[model samples]
Target: MDEWLDQLANTLATTTLREIHSVLKRAIRQAQARDMVLRNVAALVTSPTGTDGRPSKALTRQQAEAVLKAAEVSELHAYVVISLTTGVRTEEARALRWDHVVAWIPSLKTWHPVTEVGFKHRKFAIHVWRADREGGDTKTRKSRRTLELPKLAAQALRQHHTRQAVLKLKAGEAWQDHQLVFCTSVGTPLNASNVRRAFRKITKRAGLGTAWSPRELRHSFVSIMSDQGVPIETIADLVGHAGTSVTEAVYRHQLRPVITKGAHTMNTIFGDSHHG
Candidate 1:
């Protein structure tokens, strides 16, 4: 079975391999907890093949605009905007509530909620916990950091609130106060798959190319910031990455332009013949 699994891992694309690795890691951890194993064997394992597989893609601005326009009529349109604009993961967006989001229009600032998440899984499944919105914490300690959204993202959220209120009035007694910024028809927590499906449909309708996904929206946000010359240190803080190193390791290829510009700046500043 181990050999077969190894072969399976080798055959998987990068994203799929990551998912498999995550599941294996979780099972290994559970076995360790049960005294079935002293160490996690999967943790000892390494990917020999590397990421010579399908790379993750970020959405183009035009594609993002189309998606935003298509989702305009969706009840959760604001949530989509916030996720895409701020680079917060879907789980982070889903976990947000009215209390968590603070809009200070006078200051032209919006603060994202920060909270700790305690869990036992090696890779906390974003989907399962999403099914029961109250079940898990944020994905990581780094993920507990706060972010300030740009003015546009905050405005979208405000409009979404007014729209949500209308839906609540329509649902009347059936509206459950789940405190979620994004909810189902009757205010229950939305199924993560359903939300993804809806977004995919919206993208298709808007003629966004095949590169968009819930996660890609986040990638796009980071990429846009990078293009705008936001420092990796600041980007790390904005997106809840542990450090600039982690951000670069994960997104270097996507931020190649930023990297090039940084190199150019260094060359310009220090390349001249001055004090030997």
Candidate 2:
């Protein structure tokens, strides 16, 4: 079985091999539960590493700036901005809903959703609670975090809100109204292909070519934050990474970084031209 698994790993892509391995492991576990197997042998087998996949690439500060510039004219502009600035995974950004967006009212001394109170303040945030996962939750429950928005991201979302209104009017009775931050003309959720195809166009317009995807936007966020002298621990927390001490302690506060230092850093970095 080990030899056969190694041969399968060599024959398939790394992701494909991992998916097959997971399926087999779960199937064997199920069989054990049904008393059809004496032992879950699949769990005992170590899956061999397949060929290395594409090396992860992160955009430089200039490249990131260029992508934002190019994205300004596209419908996916807000999506690009949110992913790149907030370090959110593409799936999390896709699953973002209007209600999850909130603003801190200094006068009211509370955080109320933008959908409830409107984007009328300097402090805006996103509750990163959902993803395109099977149960519509983040990869791990602890990964759910609330991240403050830089002024640029807030402006982009505001503009996106207006754009979605336009789309709703055009669709009329056909609009589905899921209230997703990014969606189709009829208001349905966006699929991976839709996001990739649109993001590639933005990257190409930025002179980066078609190789870039929305996930790269997240990579760029990490790259930019790290390059600007932000602490590694803070970056890890902002990106919702697990197994870190920062994340471990953060849950006590629901992982809400007061003032969202990362967002402030981002605001200072891209805050020059995009602020206006």
Candidate 3:
């Protein structure tokens, strides 16, 4: 089985190999349950690493700024803004509704409806409790979280809400009132493919030549926060990970070690001026 996997590895990507391995293991488990096999041999077989898959990439601060600027004028501006700034998964953002958006009214000292709150007197936030998956629940229980919106994200969302209202008036009875924050002009839900295509157009307009996807915006958020010295635990919570392990494993490349603090502390204590 290992030899067969090795042969297939030459023509497949690592992710594909892992999928095949998973299927085989399931089959073996079923066979064992049926008494057709004494044991699950597939579990003992290790999956061989296959051809390199497409490498994940995140935008630099300059590129992120450019992308945000370009997206601000695009039809998908709200989608881009919310995903990048809030670090919400693309599916979760697509599943978002107006009701899930809330505003913390400082004057009232409580959370209130975004529509009713005065923009200057409140802070906007998004509750990520659903997704575009089967059953509409989030990827994990821990993924259900509330994220505060940055000023830029809030501004984009406000403009988007106004634009959507206009679209609703134009559609009149033709509008499907899903109340989705990011949706078609007629208020229909957006699928992954539609978002991906739109995202590429936005990146192209921003002068990015490399292939990019909507999900990369979330990656950019993680990388930027990590580079700025945010702790892994905090990042995990922001990204809705069940634990730091998942965040570290999935975004290992984006994470920077926090070892600089110790060195800086030592340098300050000893008055060392030599650069490493």
Please list the residue runs of candidate 1 whose C-alpha ends up more than 4 Å from where it truly belongs after superposition. Answer: 3-54, 105-143, 257-259, 266-276
By descending lDDT, how would the candidates be arranged? 3, 2, 1
Deviation (Å) of 71 in candidate 1 = 2.3
Tens digit per residue, CA lDDT, model 1, 1-276:
356556776667656666777678888999999999999988776643434666667766777788889888876588788888878878777767666664333343433232132211122111112222234453544335555556666667667767788989999999999877788878888788887788877788788744456877788888888877788888887777657888888887667455468779888998866646
Model 3, backbone clash pairs (residues 3+ apart or across chains), number: 0
- Which structure is stronger by lDDT: 1 or 3? 3
In the predicted model 3, the residue pairs found to clash are none
Per-residue C-alpha lDDT of model 2 across residues 1-276, encoded as one tens digit per residue: 788878887667787777878888988988988999999887888778888766557888898899999999999999999998998888789889999899999988878888889876889999895353444543555657899999999999999998898999999999998889989989999989988999899989999999977887777786677667676678777887654574334332222343578788897888878754
Which has the greatest TM-score? 3
Candidate number achieving the greatest lDDT relative to the actual structure: 3
Candidates in descending TM-score order: 3, 2, 1
In model 3, what lDDT does residue 216 have?
88
Please list the C-alpha lDDT of all candidates, in the order they appear. Answer: 0.69, 0.82, 0.85
RMSD of 3: 4.4
Provide the TM-score for each candidate, comma-separated.
0.70, 0.78, 0.79
- Per-residue error for 181 in candidate 2, Å, reads 0.8
lDDT value for model 2: 0.82
